[model samples]
Target chain A: AQSVTQLDSQVPVFEEAPVELRCNYSSSVSVYLFWYVQYPNQGLQLLLKYLSGSTLVKGINGFEAEFNKSQTSFHLRKPSVHISDTAEYFCAVSVPTGTASKLTFGTGTRLQVTL
Target chain B: EPEVTQTPSHQVTQMGQEVILRCVPISNHLYFYWYRQILGQKVEFLVSFYNNEISEKSEIFDDQFSVERPDGSNFTLKIRSTKLEDSAMYFCASSEAVRSYEQYFGPGTRLTVT
Candidate 1:
């Protein structure tokens, strides 16, 4: 079975400051990685996804994540953040099972951006 | 941009009562899925539907749970004899294809089994 681990439960940062949300996964086979953000009382919005090719994948809202094969990590990062960036972020891994695919998600990290 | 949509943003139901959740996936998408997120917990997959049948399901999806695409546009999930533990946010998602890996999610229906 595949699983995702988000090391931090919460991360606090000031506006315009850089932020990094850590994520790690364990899977025997190649997997697809993704980051999703959920604002207050809203459904998840896809931030980025890593399917193949480049290790550095850029996503919406100026966010990016690097897929480190050796470390089995796909950490989300932003050079600077805004108050609007405050939300619960989830890291997920999708593994192919026969003809279908399923996503295994992390516990989620709440990003609290302060002024 | 077309996106998945679910009805009944919030539902409060008594335990042991039956509740049905509805979803309208993207018109052209071929795959549909249901996932749930209990308060303060990670999102868990319930089941996946394709070709008018269930392709896969998690252990969390048991006998009491069922899914159907009764029409060309609407998909539904029925929980028989709902339990208190079933309280959570149920999300409906759809993807253009199975391998696309880009499953768009709906706003979700918050089911509160009291």
Candidate 2:
């Protein structure tokens, strides 16, 4: 089984400020990582994913995340945030079983971008 | 871009009553999934469907929970007897393939059991 841990539950930042949401995972086998954003009353939207290749992955909305295999971390970062960026961010790990796969998600970090 | 869609944005039902949440996954997707998020909690996997049968399911998916792909476009999750704990936002997702592919999500249907 695989699990994800989001270090922070809530993070508040002023508009245009940089922010990072920390995530770590535990799995016995290789895994794929992903970050998703959810607005109030909406479903999750993929921010980015780390399947393989470059450790640094860029996503939509100017967000990026770096996969640190040694540290078992995939932290999401945004150089500058806007009021519209206020949303809940989730970190997830996908573990392949046979030909199928299942996703395990973190508790989520609520990003509140203030003016 | 193609996207997954769900019906009955909100549903309120009494405990012990049956509830069915509907979803229409992106056309041509081969794998479908159902997930739920309780208030103030992380999203949890409920079940995964492929080739008209369930391929995987979580421990939370008990005897009361069932899934069906009755039609080419519709995938439904049925809770035989709703419990207060079943009140949550249920999301439907689909992927072209499960291996390292992105899953498109629906807007979700909020199920409220009272």
Candidate 3:
């Protein structure tokens, strides 16, 4: 079984300020980590994923996340944020089964990037 | 550039009535999925389908909930009887193939059981 925990329910930051959203997972086996962002009335968009290889992965919109195995964390970070970056971010985990894996998502963190 | 699409952005139904949600996956995708999120809750997986059959389903997918891929492009989810608890945003998604965990999601249909 896999589960994701997002400690922060809401994060507020001013424009051009850096931000980090924390995520942790619990699993008995290796799992794939993913970060998704949802805008108002929009669907979940894949922001980034950690399948294999490098622990630090860069994603769209100048966002990045580092997979810390020892800590069981995959925290998302951005050097600076814009007002447009205000959205709800989710962390998910799943074990790849050679087919579509059922995802377990976190409660989500609402990023309120204000000017 | 293909994307998943869903119909009936918002629906209002009385309790005990049946409601059907529709989805059209990417033309080339081979995997389809259904997920839902209550107003402020985390998104929960309902079921996953492939090759015209269900591959996996969560416990929430009970006897009252059923899924079908009747046509090449259309996938549908039907709830036998609606309850207030069933009100949520239902999202449809599709992925290309095996190991392609990146599923493209639709705008979602807001089912409101009144």
Q: What TM-score would each prediction reach against the true structure?
A: 0.98, 0.97, 0.99
> Which regions in candidate 3 have their CA more than 4 angstroms from the true location?
none
Off by over 4 Å in 2: B98-100
Give the alpha carbon lDDT tens digit for every residue of A60-94 in model 3: 99999999999999999999999999999999998
lDDT of 3 at B7: 92
lDDT of 1 at B61: 98
lDDT of 2 by residue, A1-115 (tens): 8999999999999999999999999998999999999999889999999988999999999999999999999999999999999999999999755444667899999999999
Residue B56 in candidate 2, Cα distance off native in Å: 0.6
Local distance difference test scores for all models: 0.93, 0.93, 0.95
Best model number under DockQ: 3
Better by lDDT, candidate 2 or 1: 1
The TM-score leader among the candidates is: 3
Tell me the tens digit of each residue's lDDT in model 3 across B12-110: 999999999999999989999999999999999999998889999999999999999998999999998899999999999999885558888999999
Question: Higher-TM-score candidate among 1 and 3?
Answer: 3
Worst 10 residues of 2 chain B by lDDT: B95-104
Cα DockQ of the candidate 3 complex = 0.84
- Residue B82 error, candidate 2, Å: 0.9
